[model samples]
Target: MTYLGFYILMFLGYINQLFFVPKVAREKHRDGYVPLYDSFERFYLRYVYRRVRDCWNRPITSVPGAEVYVKERVTHDYGWSFEYTGREVKSLNLSSYNYLGFAESNGRCAQNAVRVIKEYGCASCTSRNELGNSDLQVKLEKLTARFLGVDDAIVFGMGFATNALNLPCLVSAGCLVISDEKNHASLILGLRLSGATIRVFKHNNTKHLEKVLREAIVSGQPKTRKPWKKVLIVVEGVYSMEGSIVHLPEIIAIKKKYKAYLYLDEAHSIGAIGPRGRGVVDYYDCDPNDVDVLMGTFTKSFGSAGGYIAGKKELIDYLRVAGHAGCYASSMSPPIIEQIITSMTIIMGEDGTDDGMRRITQLAKNTKYFRKRLHQIGVIIYGNDDSPVIPLLVYMFSKIGAVVRTLAERKIAVVGVGFPATPLMEGRIRFCLSAAHTKEQLDYVSLVLIYNYEKDSFFFSLFMSFNKTFPVPSMAALNSLFCYRVIIFFILD
Candidate 1:
């Protein structure tokens, strides 16, 4: 049915394109000019994506806390363009990655950030190797190293660039990179730029990873059959899209057994998981030294910008000189660095307050409660119980837009994801849980989900059919028939 739906949509799209070209696609100068985009890309953008474009890239007018004020907009020509309605709707925020709830207008982090801005101004004005590197950058690197239980660390202005720019410095053409299938685009881009021979293992499946590693070791290079210069096993602490946590301990064992290097990207998990909020390594009580490289971003739990790569002092020293970011990209702003330093200090209890621990505990509590309630609600949610990133599967493309719009209308904001971010049939609404969210807020969300489930006869009937068919339908089975057609109808009408 999923494939059928896609094919039908594509067929309709092609038919529409035959008779009409979108205004955006029309060329002003066609004198021996080459088209910049593929026809299929344009078709998908104009027909498939345009139908539900209003559900994404929403403008938020206020802090992305437990609640956010989303600016309203409307489109006159399908989704070709939009105009602001001059209205902002305050909605429950399940969209932002503010895991520890540090994204705020007023707080210790915010206040410190403000002070730093006044003291150092906004921009660093140069690269780290140039005049841009500040005392704040040095302090941040030291703090980040301590936070991750590593020897030393280096900071970059952008999270994505941290991975994309550094990997080439770490590996090259003859190197073998065994990455998780669900690894982020940044990691993929980095590995590609590194010119390494890349192989993908099943997502979160340690056995498959071990299998792939063994095969790569035995096979060597394609033609020469020479041994690889180095082997790097890359995996995420928490996969953002799938909401799955990495099997870190098992992978570390595999890496040791194979004498391979492990690169752990903790972008989503750092300061969001474990008893100490130290990330996957802490969550599993593993020694930080077991992993060769530790990379993380401050954008999530810390509510700051920039990223860090933590490892041994030798690695950090090498990267400072060899990495592209340190040489070319501007250094992290003083204010952003301060935000990280302050938030991290709070997390480590260096500020002489249990506030950081309280937030971590609250986040874990909220995650467990939310996941439990969602499971009881009979929706198919992906990821481990402890992970704050939860993906509630809606399955169909049309349903993704419907759920986002419907939930927004009820004063709840969520992020809807589809291909090519995910497999075509696995479109979902990703809800990011945060410590700032109260039990009442979570309960309200659950109630809203339940209300939507019950109010729509299409979903209710589908649920009943599942009950009759399976006798005891698992979450996946129950989710197989769930549809948002009724909600879509209400929106279209």
Candidate 2:
């Protein structure tokens, strides 16, 4: 059924393009210039993606707390462009990665951030190796190392750049990288730029990883049959898209067996998982030193910007000069650095209160309760029971847009995913649970999903009953049908 829906949309897209010239094709300025986008990319963006584009990149006017005010907008020509509706929809925020609920304006974290901004200005305005490095950066690096239980750590201005820029310094020609199949784009880009031979293993499948490692060991360099310089196994602590937790202990064992170094990216896991909010290593009760490189971002759990790489002091010293980011990218803003430091201090319970542990406990409770509720509601959700990143499968492309749009209308904000971010048949809505969300708020969201699911199932059956001989409906037809269903939803309310 999922494939049928997706193919019908694609078929209609092809037919539409065959008969009429697209707006992109009619542009006069590119007489001799090469096309900026791939042919199919342009086609997908126009006919397939445009219908559902409004579901993403929603502008929010308030702090992305448990609740947020989303700026409302409307499109006159499909999703080609949009204009503000001069209204803001106050919605329950399940979109932002504010796991610990520290993304507030009046809290200690925010206050510290503001104070630092006043004292140190906004940005460092230079690279770490240049004049940009500050006392906050040094202090944060030390605190990050202590938090992760590592010898030393280096901080970077951007999370994505932390991986993209550092990986090249760690591995280059003659080295091999074994990465998870569902690894983030940043990891993929880093591995690619590193000029290393890359091998992909099944997502969270430790056995496949071990097999790949064994094969690589036996095969050695592609044609020369010579031993590789070094092998690095890179996996995320929590996969952002699939919501799956990595089998860190098993992978650590595999890395040891194969004499491979481990690079664990805890971008989504740090301060979001484990009893201490210390990430996967803590969750599994594994020694931090088992993993060679510990990378994490402050964006998700800490409610700040920047990323850090924690490892041995030798590694940190090498990266300070070898990594592109330390050499070229501007140092992290002082305010952002202060935000992380303050957040980390709270999480470490260094502020003479149990606030950090309370948040961690609350997040775990929320994750388990939400997952259990989602299962009871009969929706297929991905990931482990403890993972806070919950991906509820919607399956159909049209339904992805429908669920997101309808939920937003119900004052519940959610993020929808579809190809090429996910497999076409596995489109889903990812709901990021946070500690700040009360049980009442969660109950409301659950009720909305349950009601929406019941309506969606009924309409889906009706649509599926159409005769096979009838022509497949276009994207617009499917969207209109869903819109009508949304209207009925509100009317029945």
Candidate 3:
């Protein structure tokens, strides 16, 4: 009976109209969580599925390969399609990190990944510090530097690992690290690992950065004190959540004025911003050499998997020797490396190819069109106009979740941002746009954002009130009988 009620609500949830907030309100705590985590146990636990449906409502019948699919795919034995009751959906992929649409077709680089796989098989034989370093790996560092407009560069196994290992090596107990409040989690982890005095300034506040730098200078140079060792100011070239960009020219000036080393992580901005998509520095016309440290990921714009740090030769040289992730982790696979290397040729404007630049402009155009439409309908969009990452600020987390599910029913794929990923009160629905996304698909998403917001408010309010009245305990109470199953699941489902 419990399973029966659960399936019924789930059916309603996944169907059209509004069902998410009321269902999630019953399942997740007021804080937005539920237990029953282990994979084996989850089999019996038919969840209040919060996964956003990005593919248009067509059933995905078959997946051709990575990032490529046959339309209306049903059997997602792999890739984006999933076989649910025997229907196929060629999921229109918007949640993916492939920014340049390079992965959508079979290209030279895509074939290269396969060719390398045939040559090297799978997996790196050892860590970069040991037998794993290949000749191609060495060439990538130099190629990345030339492409990024920097003096030198070093590739990492992944973006998170780059920060995780580099932060500790660069900062120590005596140093002070000033970071933007909205910097990525990997950077936050790096700061935490550095054991330095960490002070968070307002996001993109140059004045506050100066104030902190002044305080650090004063504190470090006291009577009978030691000379200031170093200060590092970290900010993302582009923020992920709101799809906003930092004021780079000002940040660069401030960092120089304070004589502090600047760390710019261009995770989102790399393939999306600037004239040729070189990122914030390019947007501002600042010399890439002026930046003391620069890091970015290939997951998004590059349409590959990995990360890198490019800067002065000495710094890159030191990081290569001292960086923990560089030393300990397996070197990136030959295939993935080839993908990035091939991507760099196109991204660097070599061979007179402006395809990447053209794509960035197209993405910006689509984003503006969608965001403007939402604004016209009185839907608030968070972040800058040019960014494809648009956030719809909805205070209720469950509603954000429900709206994602609601939009999915409409064949629009979107994701929710709330709880630990974002502040609890700032819960929102995040629409991560890719270059391959069509105008029609985005138009549907823009409309659905407004449609679901109005449709779910009533359900959201009811569930919010219900949860406040009677909070849930562990699953231990769930299997037991309830006088009113409707009332219980609506409150504790």
Candidate 4:
């Protein structure tokens, strides 16, 4: 048969079956769980998640940013590409928690790790409560508290598991934990596990927080025999999703007015904000002592894999042997422990290079540059301009999903926020900037983003119409060229 005839036959055959296949797939999608077919779930996944999956249907390989080794950092980093995200794509790695870009190094730190391996022999095989408690771990906690300006601190293996088990251990059913509506999932799960009376305030709404605090205080007046001894106000120093900062001063005032314990999660803020990058607390010039309990994760900014909680020595001392998770979970590896010490030294301004100090300045400049260029193009930005985590908002959820898949072709990496992550109409592409991103790279990325934004309004409208009538394309001819829509995040900040 002629080549043209074969093409004609294949097109017709596909068209003839398209009707029955979609119908059957839709019916079965509602009933069956397709391992790889994720679209059929009860609730849809975010655009970025779906886009990454759709783009790499079989297996996605990643191109390395470096040739050698080091830490578990963000994005298509050279160190981690031999590394995570099996797709060999050259991307800026917007999804990683390496907020401060310390993961890209192995020089002084790697040498130390090798030395520690020879000294410690690589394993703290038992929990801290068990034989695993070493002098290093003890001194590490003390050093962390001093560096963070808190009274005491305790380090743990898993950030999520730390909270999943800690919150309940601290608060009881009688205590009312006033939580921020936008707190991380770990906080939510921990609150639920604790079986405490949870009151969610409007996200970053000090007035709302005050109202809840007042209500709790008032209710404890007469009939309440316990008189509500403790009120823990929970909020993040920097919100992970939007990169928005908390108004700590106002929140602190409200906490004081109501006599509540303010728990600030400095997850994304530490090593990225404040004097010498001491996190948001320093940025605000607020006394670290004012904050009742400070919890931060080393996975972010710090180039390690653990979490810590710092507060009054008495409280920390109680939590050490008191918490079940800490007593049972394996201690953080000697390598991570050593890395934390080195990383803290770098960020705390003990090092000569002053790289940590410069990183914060670079990130601030990059963030402003990206926001300014995007704003000039009239692209909506969410969160503070000073923040490294920027969100470009897109109001439509379904089409926002399509844009996530499209941006990859531009060689830019972005994450999408939709549905469960944000409100129904709040869909965005989260652009995480880093110190590692050079001015030229950012300049190019900004221009490409502008080009996408300029055509976005018209492109999404047209793509949605075509996609409605077409298949998502079989084996997206990676080596071939075609057109798709790209979505960026939209935020009011």
- TM per candidate comes to 0.92, 0.91, 0.75, 0.77
Model 3 stretches with alpha carbons more than 4 Å out: 1-88, 221-225, 453-493
> Each candidate: what lDDT?
0.90, 0.89, 0.69, 0.70
Global Cα lDDT for candidate 3: 0.69
Better of 1 and 4 by TM-score: 1
- Model with the higher TM-score, candidate 2 or 3: 2
Residue 483 in candidate 1, Cα distance off native in Å? 18
Q: Give the per-residue lDDT digits (tens) of candidate 1, residues 169-226.
A: 9999999999999999999999999999999999999999999999999999889899
Q: What TM-score does candidate 1 get on C-alpha atoms?
A: 0.92
> Best TM-score goes to which candidate?
1
Can you write out model 3's per-residue Cα lDDT over 61-104, one digit (the tens) per residue?
Answer: 33222223324333442122365454344444555555566664
Candidate 4 overall lDDT versus native: 0.70
For candidate 4, lDDT tens digit of each residue in 1-493? 2334334534554564455432222333445653654442411222223333432222223322211121222335211123344335555555555666767545666677678888887887888788887777887898888888878999988888778778888787677899999999999999899877788999888888898878877776335546764678989988978779999999999888777888889888888777678888889999888898888888877767888889899879888878876678988788778878887887777877787677778777777887776665466778887788888887564345556656666666666676567775576778777776777777676656644544554554554455443222122321111244322232222
Q: lDDT score, residue 384, model 3?
A: 81
If both were scored by lDDT, which would come out higher, candidate 1 or candidate 4? 1
Clashes of 2: 0
Candidate 2 lDDT by residue in tens digits, 1-493: 9889878999998998789766654545887998778878888899888999999999999999999999999999889899998999999999989999989888899898889989999987888788998888889989999998989999998999999999999999999999999999999999999999999999999888888989998999998989999999999999998999999888988888888999999999999999899998999999999999999999988988989999999999999878899778998999989889988999999999999999999999999988887876667889988999999998997998999999998999999998899986889999999999998899888877766755666775565466233233333445555776788889999
